[model samples]
Target chain A: MNKQKPSQILKTTFFSFLLIALTSCTKKSDKEVSLGALIAMTGPIESMAPPILDSVRLAEKEVNDNGGILGGRKLKVTVGDSKCSAEGGADAAKKLVNINKVSGIVGALCSGASTAASSGVAIPAGVTMISPASTAPTFTTLKDNDLFYRVIPSDAYQGVYLGKLVIKQGITKVALTYVNNDYGVGLANSFKASFEKEGGKVVTESKHEDKKASYRSELATLAQGGAEALVVIAYSDSSGQTIVRQALETKRFERFIGTDGMASEKLIKRIGIQGLKKSFFSRPVATKTSFSDAFDKNYGAFSKHKRKSIFIKEAYDAAMILALAIQKGGSDDRASVKANIRKVANAPGVEVGPGDWAKAVKLIAEGKEINYQGAAGANEFDKNGDVAGVFGHFVVQMGDSFKQIK
Target chain B: MDTLYGWMMYILSLLTVGGIYAIMGLGLNLQWGITGLFNIGVAGFFAVGGYASAIVTTKFSPNHLGGFDLPFIVGILFSMIFSGLMAAIIGKICLRLRGDYLAIATIGLAEILRLILKNEVWLTNGPRGIPGIPRPFEDLAQPWSEICYLLIILLILAIIFYGFEKAINSPWGRIMKAIRENEEAAASTGKNVENLRLETFVIGSIFMGLGGALLTHSMKYIGPTASDPLVTTFLLWVMLIVGGSGNNKGAIIGAFIIWTVWSASELLSGILSYEWINRLSYLRVFIIGFILQVILQNRPQGIIPEKN
Candidate 1:
């Protein structure tokens, strides 16, 4: 038995290596112009995926219908679930960039997932990945080699907006507890920095991990310093619901503030609307333009009765922008498409929106550049591929729905 | 030809990931298969190893300790030591308990460590984990850098695997098996079962730590999510059980099989019809569970059984 061990191991390794050698001979055709969407199809952020995915699908369908990019080559989206985690995001990105051979990727909804996907696979593979919902401030300064971009503004902007909103509401002293992760910490730190700069006292600050059974102790720690409100930065389905429920159960803090992650009716249902009495949250709002209207018209039926998440419009815009860039770039090459992203999305061009796909393609073909004012807003991507977005301040109403507050 | 090479590179990457998981599974196999020690907090030790190495090796991260900027080799060593030390502490307390108690303790241990990694921002930098970790031979160009890293990891895995095989077949391994089979009997024979169990746990954890460090270095990023207990611990357990808990080769084989299936299903879901994509995502989980069920029902000793 002992003598056979080495040979058995050698045989197994050899066999597995042979399998790899055989599989490597198989080919992936790059005939179709495929755009990959990396989203949280499963895991903690599953609730937010459907609308984003639907929006991407809607864009792909619309593009394919409208004579597709680069002389009638149909546009397709290969959807890979980021699983809203680092390792999962890396794996998803690997499949998209390597196996599927997508020209461009729109996705990796969470900040950590985005970071993981970009750094681990996307950037290394030289595949362009534009995130729709990743808002960690760290993303603003990532060493992406110009391969990464985001339609949504970083959390720094949101943090400043949240701080100003809090100050406007006369909330000087607030306890802050954010989910412990890239999104949570980035938002929390930025909010704290901005709020302190605005002369608002952060009475206490704490952080909590996701999927914990109870956070009464964390709440107690935050409440110890005696704050008027709690600013919670976390996803609604993950730590946000638990924190809100625990706070209400303990009756530690009545008034709560949340970021985009907590801006959902799902949160209201998790911790009853009655439980979220004086709570309000901030999220990026879709511009009520023709583009937004077009999105609602296209995806509204598919996403019937589901509460709209913050990044659905942004997701639509991300897909549309990538497709438009591909059209404008007039090439199937990844690098050329990446180069045209800023040119087509930014300023000094004819204005275009969601309904102008064919027109936009026509204009680009005629050598006249067109700026894509997407559903999110005038998506004039900065050098970093980030666009400034409008923020909505919403308060929970009597019927478990959020009514946007002035 | 480019497409074929792309597929080859993709497989190479997948194998790299599998290699790391196999190392982790091997660590778990040593504990559960050979010593009858159930350690579910594999992620905790992994996190400790990863974070320790990340902190020590990288230039100081703002809001967290850094600036040590040790070499990659030093980072690997630091990770192993840190993880082994953590296992020693955890083992001292939890090893007294048996079976389910140990499982619960380990689960809680991993959860607590995850919480610590999250909330202790000044230490672990909260959720904005340490990124931009330097891979070995990173200065090398494109495919070469990756290929070099893969070769290095393969060499490391080979060493660990060979050493493990040697250790398991030795008198120490027999004693471990004895303690695993009948702890009281081994104790009556003056084998010092508790001490032996502690040693086995620590040694196994050292490999796990090295695996974690390799993962962090390879990805060149580490976050709380990277060490997620469900992804790391549970998945590794499944690999061990599926591969054959008592068989070292089985552990490595199980890792490759399960990880390949896990990733390949995601690719399949992407290719499927739009209407079925969402359902297929859930079905992927079902497939994994179903595979486990089938494996358990048919080959309960796993595809490769213990060579007793």
Candidate 2:
């Protein structure tokens, strides 16, 4: 009986293993295409991830509902939160690539996280990453690798836009308050250089430590410099909000201009409508594409609110681009999907939105041409896989809404 | 429904993070509350553990510092031992100094360690960090997979906590406390005060290293930024001070509560109107500071003070 028990146990274990493997293989065979998203669902940038994720989901649903990517083969998306930190981003990337075996990924939103994850795991494993919103200029020169791409224009372009905006506003002198991190420092320096080149003067520049309270002294110094306008390049954290509040409370500058990081509704909410009245910031203009409207509708319904974020638009566009690329490549293979990403993203001709993903995919699969004009705007991919878009300056009017001023 | 789920997930994540902090805080509690060793370099030892485990287990290549791809259990064990060795060396050098001088020396050492991590790109990947670490039990099926993994981690943590409680109640623990209270007397009693102090420092650091290793695994990423003195050093001290210095339960509770508050505030700031939540973010830190002040003023012994 004891000898029979050992054989019986071994037989049961083998059968169990076989069943598991067979089930897994069958599940894989049932899916036509698989994609992954690594977003900062928790941590400092967690607030920004929801919009992006919502958009991705919406795009995925549209594609799958329209008879999948490769003719009846459905596309599936697996989401992982990167926590906006380098380590978290890498881990999320690894899970998506190693465990999920996804063909493409959509995020690692923050520059530092994206950089770390791309170098640490994504590039090494040959997984394609296309960041929709990460705008750090250094990404352009990242190890001469082609695996990483961004849909948004680099900070360098944004700096130039801000510089032109400053000139347009006739603000002769500006005071710069930047966070002491790579994102802030890069934007601040670029803005300074562009502004100086455009014959505008930067009165004073200072850096604020992250998560620091009481920037009254720093604002006091900037106010004392007698600059007509103040430009803040920082994230939407407590410290950055405090800096904005203090600048207004101290009555230092006439008007405040900020980068995309400070362009969130959360920033205005933090400072209050009264404080935000005189503030203007540069952000990617939200195009009135059908895809964007659909995303907005879905997200508003999901959040049970009337408002939607800019990141939602970017994320939706990223997912659509990825799906279109897969269809265009004629396969769900990682390398093929990656190679066709730029082709679909920048396909010359008619524009396609989220609702038209089916038609777009069909056309691409049929070997016809297509161009994707996303909810965020014209997604024309350059050599570096970055999209060039128009930057608009908006004035915070009331109730977490902004009035776009050309 | 999604929002509530989001909150629950957030709470779970915070608890996981707090569990790590609790372990590190316990290490601090052992040194300051029991052995009276002022270790301002807590973050340094933690970073050492993370880097050691990462480099040891990662697949090595010619262009990069190759890792052995050893089992994570073995990597963690080695990391703890290495951290203990480093702490012993540092403790021997700095234990002779008393009061603020020792604090300053340890703080300086912590800064030096951070700089080394930042500059040694060839070894530590510089400021960019190491990513794509393998998680234990990742091969399991989904649905209950993550939960099972978390349960395993929690079980390990419980064992460590119970083990620590047992050690603190032992004769060795009593001697360490004796040295803390009256060093000269402990020396006169042939306790070999220096050796005792060094031994305590090493043991405490081993715990810190283990805590760091667990954290890296949970996060699945390790970076120099994670080891920043601001995040590691300040938060660990806050947990230890607010939780009650000498109590294990206090440490765990403090970590959970503080981390919960921190994470909740972040979520709340996202959901609430920007106006209401904006200033609240900055105010959150001050709130913690206020909590610390209140704790010190009202209950100097902490919510769970160490017992004699």
Each prediction's DockQ? 0.46, 0.09
Per lDDT, the best of the predicted structures is 1
> Isolated chain A: TM-score per model?
0.77, 0.81
lDDT of 1 by residue, B1-308 (tens): 55666678788888898999998888999999999998898899888888888888878668687837989999999999989998999899899999999999988987887778767878877777877777787777768878898898888888889989999999999999998898898899887888999999999999889888998887777887888776788789899999999999999999999989888888876768766877876787788889899999999999899998
TM-score for predicted model 2 compared with the true structure: 0.62
Poorly placed runs, candidate 2 (over 4 Å): A1-8, A19-23, A44-52, A168-173, A180-183, A199-201, A209-216, A223-228, A234-256, A260-281, A297-307, A393-405, B1-44, B47-191, B199-225, B228-308
Off by over 4 Å in 1: A1-30, A162-184, A195-286, A301-309, A392-406
> How does candidate 1 score on lDDT?
0.84
Question: Model 2 over residues A286-374: C-alpha lDDT tens digits?
Answer: 66767567656666665533346656677777788888878888887778877887777775756676578777866766667888877
lDDT of 2 at B132: 51
Residue B271 in candidate 1 has what lDDT? 65
